[model samples]
Target chain A: MTIRILTEGELRSCVDIDREAMETVASGFRGLGEGRAVLPPILRLDVEDANGEMDVKTAYVPGLDSFALKVSTGFFDNHKLGLPSLSGMMTLISAHTGRVEAVLLDNGYLTDVRTALAGAIAADTLARRDAKVAGIFGTGLQARLQLRALALVRPIERALIWGRDPEKAAACAQEMAASLGIPVEACAEGSAVCAEADILVTTTPARSPILQAEWLRPGQHVTAMGSDAEGKNEVDPQALARAERLVVDRVSQCARLGELHYALEAGLVEETQAVELGDILVGKAEGRCSDEEITFCDLTGTGVQDTAIALFAHCRAQARGLGAAIEA
Target chain B: MTIRILTEGELRSCVDIDREAMETVASGFRGLGEGRAVLPPILRLDVEDANGEMDVKTAYVPGLDSFALKVSTGFFDNHKLGLPSLSGMMTLISAHTGRVEAVLLDNGYLTDVRTALAGAIAADTLARRDAKVAGIFGTGLQARLQLRALALVRPIERALIWGRDPEKAAACAQEMAASLGIPVEACAEGSAVCAEADILVTTTPARSPILQAEWLRPGQHVTAMGSDAEGKNEVDPQALARAERLVVDRVSQCARLGELHYALEAGLVEETQAVELGDILVGKAEGRCSDEEITFCDLTGTGVQDTAIALFAHCRAQARGLGAAIEA
Candidate 1:
């Protein structure tokens, strides 16, 4: 009956953007595809006065003993007050007794890691096997974590960074080159990112298309993990139509907020053309038919990822004796 | 940032079934009626294996500094193992920064208090000014709380308790008589309880109508607070058709899961016939027009009440220095 409370620093000590995390998320997707999971639509509350939005996401995977209910808040104006714009906590409930067992005060750390791992999962499932070049569009924490995650699954040896702010992208490039021990360059033209990189990830918060359909080439795999909202579009709608294969985290969600939403709106690509990452992971649908075929994946975050990552981090924290267990 | 954790005992010490608590929940409804509150649709996760359901409810009221995000779980089979069927916790988030301020581990104590008070609000507004006898249909905790709450707002000299189990109802009646210092009687006939009581509250789990419309009379007000699922009904739909005034916690929710749902499905009442309790609380809609009017208010509950009650408890707990604050 005691509930464990784990902090962000403690979770960061155990859970990382690694292979274990990838498979943890991959297992949730497998359950989703195999039809053994229950994922409810996200509950979102928006406050116009504070420019804030709080999203509640959760899912139940049968094999797992407990489910994670995560409350994530994003107050866009927090930066002006010297506070991080995003913060959240997760409550893990026992499936058998329906009692809460733990409170994860990760403050969005688990979310950041899980999101990065999902990007890696999409790339590992859809990208060319011998793909060595990695490129990302955002110069932020996700930009660094995604490439680092890609290196864990793909044979990524060189990387390119693209950003609206060239200085930030250049700084990101230098950091990635030193940390990853690979050749990382800040590209001046966006088309070069679409053309040269075997694996391209758009991590920006662009409202309009940053990656164009005309710039894409054969054998290229695109993973757009940048933004998710009704208005967020990183790649052109036509870009999805240009790819030989299109994949999504969830077709239903992506059809509403992901790249496929715009594609379906413009009559460029039908929703049926896109296969979910879960279906591919479970072999229920086809992934890459050939290395020569272009692939594109839109990454809109899911509740199952949160549940899987939270449970994984909770287990690690418990094993390491890193959290406080108050018998309240 | 720090999160204060308050347990059930601490919450009960400060928050109670009283006038102050009534006003706190009343203010939330007023804000909701004034069109300043933001309530998101509830998110639910069902686990068929365990016969469990996890419900997440939240709301944002502009004037309240923090809004509450509540996670409630119900596992029906837990009683076999000597556990309560329902358990939950509420997290209060700062509306200014969207930061976690406290976690109220009330374990559904706050929900019970708020729910009972909502029944009082309905009775106080719609019941006759001369209401002296309060009757409830269930023999559980709510059966007692509703009468206690009604006593706060009305001049009640006696109370009636009705249930499927006559022995349990008689025991509850004796216990209530000793506690409330009122003449309490457990009646075998549900029709007798309906005919004698001026204010009636249904808190049962019965699937069929326990209160018949043929027995209802003028100058009587009914508060049906039991069972919120699709198939549960404690009062007949025809009873609503007979009522002079009809009120609901929220029309959208009532249309889907409340007594109004059943009434609408039976084509006995129109959706527009039911006015929100908030509207009456804020003077946006009319309540009881005459002493001879038969009023029925359906209380399916709302997120605003959670936000209000949690905030009230947090403020009192802070004033009394009652919780453990962890700087995680």
Candidate 2:
């Protein structure tokens, strides 16, 4: 057997967050909800002394030719050494033979794009069709990617960016506006940003709630994407309780490391009450009941997403001969 | 960063179950027991419809320069397709930067060697010093590797072989005797094999107990290398309970997927009663207390072994200029 290795540049040149990719991710979520996917709980290791953490995730979807094993590592103190904190590689294996097929050394670039595609899918399925403003919390790669992703689903013409560093927020807003041809503004007041936007995306790794219930408005859809670990919070428990409908990428994951964990601890939302995004995609659950109802989705990321994206990238790379093939 | 892709042939040439490699694995176990290693619970995925199973394991030792993420896949019916039943690859990451260091596409070759090394380490620590006759219970790759490994620790001049198929057992015995320059006999009776052997290794993936307490003799050390899954067992619970000293590669793993799981469930042993092999290596636990005592070790394998072996293989390959290096 031979295994292909795709570098970051090659992956970027072949794959993008577009309609087809979004549809693939949406199908992954559907597969999970429909019980056609084997996704195990993520394996996480924390090296407190080194300020490092690593998570390994994988999934096998029936009828798919291959599966993916992703190992993502984060060294919180890497910024001090002028290196990015997040990096990882994904290994793809043949489902039929259980042989190594490809390895995507994208340096978490594909993870970012797949995650953004997930955000877009949530917006497409749950947000208001005529949503004009997308509010974002955080001024990082995800903040920019999420806005670009939302525009593909809703008619978002403007964006409001908020961050602890005002200068970073302003700079990100300017860059995004120039690139996406959307009017973007940096907001100092979080509540004001929430009040004006039809959709809000929380992208900060905050331990405490950053988006309070008092700041939420009706007819808004909030996609909280930052809380993928325990002790991480983006939206307040009260805000989640106030939502007319609460959606999650996966019920089991949300109960452990998502916004629903905090809401569950506060006795605000019952585990049975939360809807799964996959169920919504598969027509087993409702998404947004009405345009005037506040909706929240806790996305703790799933192994199926990694599998879908990795398979998609590998197929595309093979078609275009974008990676180097070596002996296995 | 660049990642060197090592093929199975290159890995086979560079790594073997020798004294140095066994020592490396032993030290890894010690690191885990000393709390100097970060090993998360293994992430396992099973596609029941396809008879496919995959496990993702990783560990970070504080002083190690690199860590390893090993993805092992098993497709039980692959022999029907004229293919090996198992295939996998290990990705080595630089601990300080979390960047890709090398990819060992050993295709489970390294896993087999490391597992054998673990068995050898158990025998070296728990078996009697003058153990001469080594007993093995299978005719597979692991069965051969384990006997070869045991010869390194003790003066195993003879091996008693037992298998359901006498022809296969006879063939294996002949091959091992010719290669290792030892007297190997294939015995038709299980109890007779156990009675004549000083060190016994169980290497079959049997669902029920193959070794009974009634057959065990004093000064005998049994290494149960099978029973890595929920329903697989190599020895009877009664046999384990009767052992004077019980040891395991990892306590948590033994409680869930090893022979100790059955023993604990049968009330034959407690989780606290079994000692960790690493603790013994680190001088925290006792190995074989006396020559007249029967001892048993459940070898379920661990991520620390993967890390240690992968790192060792990568370094050796680099020094010898093996494998292909490409941009990642």
Candidate 3:
């Protein structure tokens, strides 16, 4: 048997946060919404001594010839050792023969790309058509990607950034300004950014809520993509209660590990009140009912997205003949 | 990051079913017995179209520097395509860093070695000291390995083989006779094999009992290693009730998917009556107490065994510099 190996650079060269990639990911959401995909719960492993954890996510979509199974690592103390805090790889297996087709050593790149695209999908379906200002939390890799991704869907003219470190936030703002050719500024508090922007995306790994309910204004859409694990929350539970509409990537997962977990814990949200982004994308559920409605979407990330992004990466890399192939 | 890829031939050249290999797998049992290993439940996915299923098992032992995550495939229809019914690979990651250190593309070779070694460990700990004859059920790769592994510790001078097909059983017996320098014969009845042999092993994909309770004679020991999934049983549940001592690889796992599941359903076994193979290995529980006592062990396999065997293979392959390393 022959298996292909795609390095991070090869994958980066083939896939980008563009329209084709967005549509590829949108099909994944549609598959999940239509119940044509088999997405299992995350298999998690914890290495207590190193203060690191690994999450294994996978999904099988019959429409695709291959499915992606991802292993994502979070070593919180790796930065002290001059290594990045996040590193991982994805494996694609043939849906027909049950053999591994390729291994993508993306080191969390595909995860970042797919995560950013999910934010754009959420905003495109829920945000007002004329929304121009964006607010971003966390000055990490995702912070920059989220802003760029938003610009692709909405008329994002400028953005406000908030982070724990003021200098890092300012640096991120300057970097985004140069990349997007839009005015960007660092905000001292998340509340200020939340109240002023038309679209707000929280990308921080905060254990406590960063945005409050009172800060949520009408004609605004919020997407929380950072809370993919337990004990991680970005928006206040009261905010979920106050929003005119609440949506999630997957109701079962969000209620267990995302911002919706806290909202459910506080009895501020009902299980039935939540709608899925997949359903909204396929027009099975309403997204933005009115321009004055406050919309909230909590993304815990799903295996369907991984399968979509990995399959897309494979096709692109094969077309370019960019990855290494080995016989087994 | 650098990942070493070891082909099946490279791995086979370095490791075998020797005493050192058994001890390596033994340490895994010790870790689990002492409550120092973190083993998560298997993540399983089913592909209906291919008539196949995938099992992902992993474990972290604090005493080991590296842990193994294994993905195994069982495609029931692969033989019709001139391929093996089972295939898989294992990945070893640093316990301290949670990084993918190496991928052993053994294509189920490592699993086979570890599984056979588990059978040896069970027989060595539970069989009579002077046992000289063995009875093997099934005519698969595992049936042969179980016999070869049993001889490493016992005075096995002769063996009886049984299978659904008489020609395959005869061929297996001839093969074992040539390799082991012992008298091996094909038996027509599983009951006759069970009643005569000092040690018995069942290694078939049987959905019903193959060995009856009345056939279980005193001074005979049975090791059933084929019932790793639900709806597979080799020994009658009544045999479990008749045996003087009942052991399992892992109590909770066996209770859910092994022979113990059927026994528990039939009210022939009690949850508290079962003892673990690890506890037996560590002297925490008693093994065969007398030559007249009948001992039976049900092995459904464990992730700890994978970690132990994979770490051993990685060390040997690295020492000999037998694998290809890729920098990412």
Q: In candidate 3, what are the lDDT values of residues B1-328, reduced to their tens digit?
A: 8888887888999989999999999999989888878888888878777787888888888979988888888888888888887878888888777778888878889999999999999999999999999999998999999999999889999999999899999999999999999999999988778767999999999999988889889988999999998889888999999888999999999998898999999999898899998888788999999999999999998999999999999999989988888887
Report how large a share of the reference interface contacts model 3 reproduces: 0.33
- Candidate 2: residue A18 Cα off by (Å): 0.8
Angstrom error at residue B154, model 3 = 1.3
User: Compared with the true structure, what per-residue lDDT tens digits does model 1 show for residues A1-328?
Assistant: 6888888888889999989989999998888888888999889999888999998889898889989998889999999999999999999988898888899988889989999999999999999999999989889999999999999899898999999999999999999999999999999989888768999999988999999989988999999987678899999999999999999998888998788999999999998899989999999999999978999999889989988998899898988998887665
Over the full model, what C-alpha lDDT does candidate 3 score relative to the true structure? 0.90
| Per-model CA lDDT versus the true structure | 0.91, 0.91, 0.90
The local lDDT score (0 to 100) that residue A256 gets in candidate 3 is 94
Top of the candidates by DockQ: 1
Candidate 3 residue pairs in clash (backbone atoms < 3 Å): none
Tell me how far the alpha carbon of residue B77 in candidate 3 is from the true structure, in angstroms, after superposition: 2.3
Q: Which stretches of candidate 2 lie over 4 Å from their true place?
A: none
Better candidate number, 1 or 2, judged by DockQ: 1
Clashing pairs in 2: none
Alpha carbon lDDT of residue B295, candidate 1? 97
**Which CAPRI tier for candidate 3?**
medium
Off by over 4 Å in 1: none
DockQ metric for all predictions:
0.78, 0.75, 0.62
Candidate 2 positional error at A20, Å? 0.9
For candidate 3 chain B, the 10 contiguous residues with the lowest summed lDDT are B91-100
